[model samples]
Target: MESQELEFHTAEEDAGLRLDVWLTEKLSDVTRSFVQKLIEDKHVLVDGSAVKSGFKLKKGMTVRVRIPEPVSAELKPQDIPLDVVYEDADIIVINKQKDMVVHPAAGNWDGTLVNALLNHCGDSLSDINGVIRPGIVHRIDKDTSGLLVVAKNNAAHLRLSDMLKRHEIVRTYEAIVDGVIREESGRIDAPIGRHPTNRLKMAVTFRNAKEAITHYTVVRRYPSHTWVRLKLETGRTHQIRVHMAYIGHPVTGDPLYGKKCSLMDTGGQVLHARFLEFMHPTTGQFMHFEAPLPDYFTRLVDLLESRSSGG
Candidate 1:
């Protein structure tokens, strides 16, 4: 793989933003974690000086970034079954199951959505998401189950990514939170950045964080929990989980952001990407697809229904 030297001039509007945060806003295709990796690798420099992700930007500062091509792993096509929701010549949408990593990474080198796409689409998927993620346009976390769309070609990928950046693509999820939400609806408009102490986690920060918005409605209230439907105005990694946790109602079974498993009873985070709506890349028609709540979510509903009915 080769590296490209890229220079980005900060816009006047982007003045006073943190370097890493500014870069993340500019480069929406690549993830924040990947950008942070580049920064830690000394692949990014502000005015030719190596700095941390917290380095604040000044107007007219020329930011140089060395983006190396993702290392191509020898990923063979796997015959994993996919819960495909919709498909056309331009894009394919799938109901991704929980615990399934979207792309090949450190420990998980197979059974990824890429491997399945390679098998299902043959060689038709786009290479825009790098070698590891051949067709993926967006991603949900490993523990978050939901609908995701993959582009079949570069044109589709570019169009879909552009729509996402403009917040034209609507993504919604349903999550079982730890506490009952007293309000019928609410919004979380916090800026999210990497954790100041833990590099692996993300948190809401007054500085160095990107603008995030989450709108949620309480669908069902339990004695100790609430099943909330979430609509994302901005898609950040762990956006729903992090925002919910920040608002004092972490997703039930979320180990990273919430208290221990003793506080809740579920396999993992009870969050599901339930619906996706966007314009068709080729046809220009509005499209919407939904993945039914998984079995575990159904089980929770059954239990909650019983309790709510005074069973």
Candidate 2:
């Protein structure tokens, strides 16, 4: 693989912005931390001179960035168990367990759903997402248990990706959040992007943000907690968690976006992808799948119910 170089001229509106921030806005796929790393490695230059990531840009200043090719590594197969709900020649739907990563990334090199799929499906899985993420069409957070569909071939992958982009695939999630939601149903329409100061977190912002919408309905309400059913109109990263937190009802046990709660000792956010509906890529038939909540989630809900009933 060959390295790619990108050049950009700072516009009047972009002047006085930090170099890394400018680049992050210009390169939507890359992160600010990665841009800073490129600056530290001297791969980013201002007018052919190496500059710090925080250097303020001037109007008409030329910025050049050199992006090295990603190193390709052979993914090893793992014998991790999978709760496969449906399988066919074109795709497979799995009820992913909590705490299980969907694919291998920086710190996680093995024991992911991709690795498990490699062993389970052999070479039948799609390679559209590269070897590191074979057959993976979409992802849920590592701690968020849910249902996901994996493509078995390139054609299937392309169709699924297109359907997801058009918002034709139906995905519904169930979560328990802090505080009682007074509204019977509501929609959160906000743009989401990387947090300006905290790069590790996503926030609702208009700057270089993508449109995200989440529709939620109250399923049940306890004294202090509320269970909600959510449907995504746009699948932005951390959309559900960020939106729920933005509305002041963060998901219970969500360490990143919500306060700590002892009622659910599940070690992660109380969120689950309960239902999925989509058209099969090969057969063109409508398909639907549902996953039952894990014992931990059910138990916590029961506890909340008991408390609400004064038991």
lDDT of 2 by residue, 118-142 (tens): 9999999988888788899999987
lDDT of 2 at 251: 90
Regions more than 4 Å wrong, model 1: 1-72, 260-265
Cα displacement (Å) at residue 287, model 2: 0.3
lDDT of 1: 0.83
Question: lDDT per residue, candidate 1, 1-311, as tens digits?
Answer: 45666677776766777777667544423455768888999999888889999887878887888877666579889899999888888899999987678988643567788888889999889998778889888999877898999999999999999999999999999998888899999999999998775444689997788999999999989887899999999988878878999999998877567743443356568899998998898888989898889987888777877777888
The top-ranked prediction according to lDDT is 2
**Candidate 2 at 270: error in angstroms?**
0.4
Candidate 2: misplaced stretches above 4 Å? 1-73
lDDT, candidates in the order shown: 0.83, 0.87
TM-score for all models, in order of appearance? 0.76, 0.77
**How much does candidate 1 score in TM-score?**
0.76
